[model samples]
Target: MDKDLEHRFITQLEKHQNIVHKVCRIYTSGQDEHNDLFQEITIQLWKAFPKFRGESKFSTWMYRVALNTAITLYRKSKKSVRGDHYEHVLNNLKYNEYNDEEEQQLKLMYDAIKQLSDVEKALIFLYLEDRSYKEISETLGITEVNARVKMNRIKSKLRTILNP
Candidate 1:
C-alpha cells in the first residue's frame, strides 16, 4: 500500500512537474534558488499527498501547494535574490521558434512578469497556463469575482511595465 501510494505520487508529479518548474522560475532569480525552491515544493507536495482526496485536479492542487511553498519560504528567507541568470533558464524554457522581434517581445514580457508581486505572479502564471478564473480563485483562495478583478489589474500592471 505504501509503495502504491508512492507510485501514484511519483506518476502524478512526473506528469505535472512543469507546473512546479514554472512556479519556481517565477519566484526565483537564479539557478540555485530555483533548484532549492523546486525541492521544497516537491517535499511539500509529498507531505500533502496522502490527504489529497481528489477534490481538485492534481495540477490545481499542485498550484496551491507550490504557490504556498514558494510564499512561505520567500517570506521566511532573509537572503536577497542576486545575479539575474536569465540566459540559462530562458534557453531551457524556450518552446516555439520566433523571429528576432518576437524574441525581444517575449524577453520584455518575462522581464515585466518578474517585476510583479508574488500573488500577482502566481495569477499571471496560472492565467498563462490557460487555467480558468474558477481554478485561479480556488488555487489562490480568492473569489471568482476577485480573481477577475485582480487579473484585470495584473494586465494593466504588465502593460505599464512593458510600455514604460
Candidate 2:
C-alpha cells in the first residue's frame, strides 16, 4: 500500500477499531484467543481495504468483514467459555451497578451464546450493537426478513438457555 493509503487506512482503522474488539470478544473465549482473532481480523481488513469502496459506512463494512472472518476464516479449537472469564468481561461492561444475579445471568447468556452457531452469534452481536435489521441483513448477506426471524429465534434460544 502507498503511504497515503496506508495512513488513511490506519487512521480510519484506529477510529473504528472497537468494532473489531467487540466481535473478537463475542467470538473468542479467552484473552489470548481474543488477541489472536483481533490480529487475524486486522490482517483481513488490511487485505480487503483496497476493495472497500465507500458505498456504505466504514464501520458497517468493517462489521461485515470482521463477522465473515470470525465465522468462516478463524478456526476456534476451544469451545467452552469459563464463567469466571465472563466476570472479567462484565467488569468492563457499561452497567452502573454489578450484582451477582446480573453477573450470573450475563455469564449464562454468554455461555449460551457460545453454544450458538457462528451465524446466530453474528446476528446476536449485531443486534446487541444496535444494528438495524437492514444493516444486519446486509452485513450477513441475508434478507431483512430472515435477519428478523433469526434474531427472534436467537432471543428465544437465549431465554431457554438462561431459564433452563
Q: How does each model score on TM-score?
A: 0.81, 0.79
- Per-residue alpha-carbon lDDT of candidate 1 for residues 1-164, written as tens digits (9 for 90 to 100): 37677778877877788888778877877668877777677777877899999999999999999998898789787343332432233233323221234335456677889899889989999999999999999999999999999999999999999888
Steric overlap count per candidate: 0, 0
- Which runs of model 2 end up more than 4 angstroms from their true locations? 75-106
Best by TM-score: 1
By summed lDDT, the worst window of 10 consecutive residues in model 1 runs over 90-99
